[model samples]
Target chain A: MNREYKTGEIQAGKPVQQVPWLEWLAAGIGLFLVLGIFGVIGWQALNGATVPPVITVTVENVTPVEGGYRVLFRAQNTAGEAAAQVEVEGKVSTDSGEEVSQVVIDYVPGHSDRRGGLFFTRDPSSGTLAVRAIGFADP
Target chain B: MTSERYAIGLARAFGGAIIFGLPLLMTMEMWSLGFSMGRGRLLLLVGFTLAVLVGLSYFSGFEKTFSLKEDAMDAFAAFGVGVITSTLLLVALAVITFDMSWGDIIGRIALQSVPASVGAMLGRKQLGAEQDMQAEEERKQEAGYAGELFLMLAGALFLAFNMAPTEEMILIAFQMTPWHALALGVLSMLLLHVFVYSIGFSGQESRPEGGTFLSTFLRFTLAGYGIALLVSLYVLWSFGRTDGVAVAEIANMLVVLGFPASLGAATARLVV
Candidate 1:
């Protein structure tokens, strides 16, 4: 804390009067970030939608596991609101019977996608597979 | 020599940012809340945090400041350090990826920067040399009653911000009955008073000359607890914990969060 002050920079018991250029540079960067963040949020407030989450689930692939078949799917929320506890159901219509597999995604944010896997005892590739988001809870 | 001191201060600011910001930075709830939270509320929060940082700089900035302009500059500099630190950490952790929207990235960084900036502002007091701390102590004594309350508010906000983003706040509230809430509230206030007045921490304040126990309790302890509760509510609301929540549940949550907030308020002198 032993600051070296110039002749005119200090008065009796007062802090040094002159600020360094580096301080100003740091402050400028901060100001930019603050303003930029504010602007982005403000823009979103003006234009962001308030629609409920609309989730679309699509199966990515089906693979064989040791005991069963694994169906990987991606859940995409196209709406402006996020959803929690989203239920994605995959149904397979085979010559033998109809098999259903369900998986719950914890969260699917607006305009974002989440991947999950559903397990089925029967091979999903052997039947016509139908995958869709059944329901979602508001986040 | 001045430049060298400033450089050291800057490095300390970075260290402080990491130490204070790490908890919130690693929180999964905080990362999600950034994008899920209401944009208007998020904006208000960022604006409010900047104001708090400026006030903190006035009391104990990274450098000795003689004027409001100096304090404001330091506040902004602290914010810059916070934003940079948050951005770098988020990237390293894979929380901020190339595929994410710019909005999500900005939101995450903005929310995290609140605590990081406060840490940077307090870097001087926590990490500075001994003589620097003495100077800050002198500056703190110059503050009056209003200033003391403001410090309490800042302290409460800091602690509440740390816990409010977690799901446990609401979960604990839901688990508590009305009787439990009442007991916890009383216990929180009692602990807060003991920490500030009864116990003699290193930076503890002595009772003012001729100040009676009742007067001190009413003026500092009670008022500090009130501020703590208010700050807790604000933090909870900012994190969207109050959305669609029942009134009784909200009250319970307030009590739960108020416990830590009160401790933070009581320890303001030692910490802030």
Candidate 2:
């Protein structure tokens, strides 16, 4: 067996076993992607996303589902931690003072918008739908 | 690299990625973390994973020999293999697609890559046959108690990080009764001690100073499990999995996370 190469060990006119081209290619691409992930996440995190004390819920669309009408809503979390089992309540003004419906969202990651639905007996479109984040427990 | 040699390594890496990263690839919370994890935290995790990869390369990596530059390069290469394999699998499963934002695409692939990279680094060690019992003997001679402990810690971290971000960890804890939790705790400690004691992996330190069953258990096995729990708790916190829960709940979460972590610790010698 040939002896192992020492540090900077090479002979004149003998082509060093070409460091496998694939290794270099792999190394380069890996570093680039890792740094890219950091750059993308860091930039957005610093500039755009912030986890507020409370999630802000906005009703996006009111659609009819099987049992009742569903309120399609988005909750925006700007904070640093994910909130699970977030309770969102929707209140609509009808001829009766108000009709309230509540739904629990499974998970809302910080700094992202997650869509959920609130099933309501009354039509949300007919009346004004006011959605609010009632409470969230940390996962 | 020889064509045949490269083929073997690539195949091993592919298999390793699937074996290690498949569950995480399918997990929704993992997908969530991939996209929504704060940049600062994700960057730190990536950096930490890189450092650990380099260290693992020093002990047991895909490379045949230990060279700093080579190990560093191989670390990146291993990570590349991890990323590529993860991307392909997730895409095949439709977990990743063209319509998703760049953040989501990058997040899921990169997060899963962490475990995949470790598996890639460990491919030859775990998947391939042992070629050098001499090297194994040398490692056993040189890797004293502290070194063995480090390997266990690395193993714990690798396994704990895989599942800590998911909501299921806490959910499982909540589902378990106190008796079940205690039974699991006893099982964890027992398994940890048994694996390290009965199994003779390459770096199994025969005995630390003051060698005795009691001493070994107290010093290494018990301590190793402690590190596993601590690592579990830390990973949970870092992922914000433990953000607003009660202290008791946190303890449960740690134990739940610690189970796999302890298994990792017990098997560290085989992998690292």
DockQ of model 1 vs. true complex: 0.46
Residue A34 CA error for candidate 1 (Å)? 1.3
lDDT of 1: 0.85
Model 1, A78: alpha-carbon shift in Å? 1.5
Top candidate by TM-score: 1
Residue range A1-139, candidate 2, lDDT tens digits: 1223322243223333645666667678878877776787776577655454358988788888887788888897766556778898989887766788888887666555677877888777777889999898654
Cα lDDT tens digits, model 1, B1-272, are 26677888888899899999999999999888888888889999999999999889877778777677777888999999999999999999999887776677888899999999998888777887654566566666767688789889998999989999998988888899899999999998898888887889977778878999999989998999999999998988887888888888889999999998998898888877
Looking at model 2, the pairs that clash are: A50-A78, A50-A79, A51-A78, A51-A79, B34-B107
Question: TM-score of the candidate numbered 1?
Answer: 0.91
Q: List the residue pairs that clash in candidate 1.
A: none
Q: Model 2 lDDT vs. the true structure?
A: 0.75
Tens digit per residue, CA lDDT, model 2, B173-249: 99988788888888999988877777676555566566888888889889998999988987877676776779888
> Where does the lowest 10-residue lDDT sum fall in candidate 1 chain B?
B130-139
State the displacement of the C-alpha of residue B53, model 2, in Å, after optimal TM-score superposition.
Answer: 1.2
Q: Where in model 2 is the C-alpha error above 4 Å?
A: A1-18, A53-139, B1-7, B175-183, B199-205, B208-210
Relative to the true structure, candidate 2 reaches a TM of 0.76
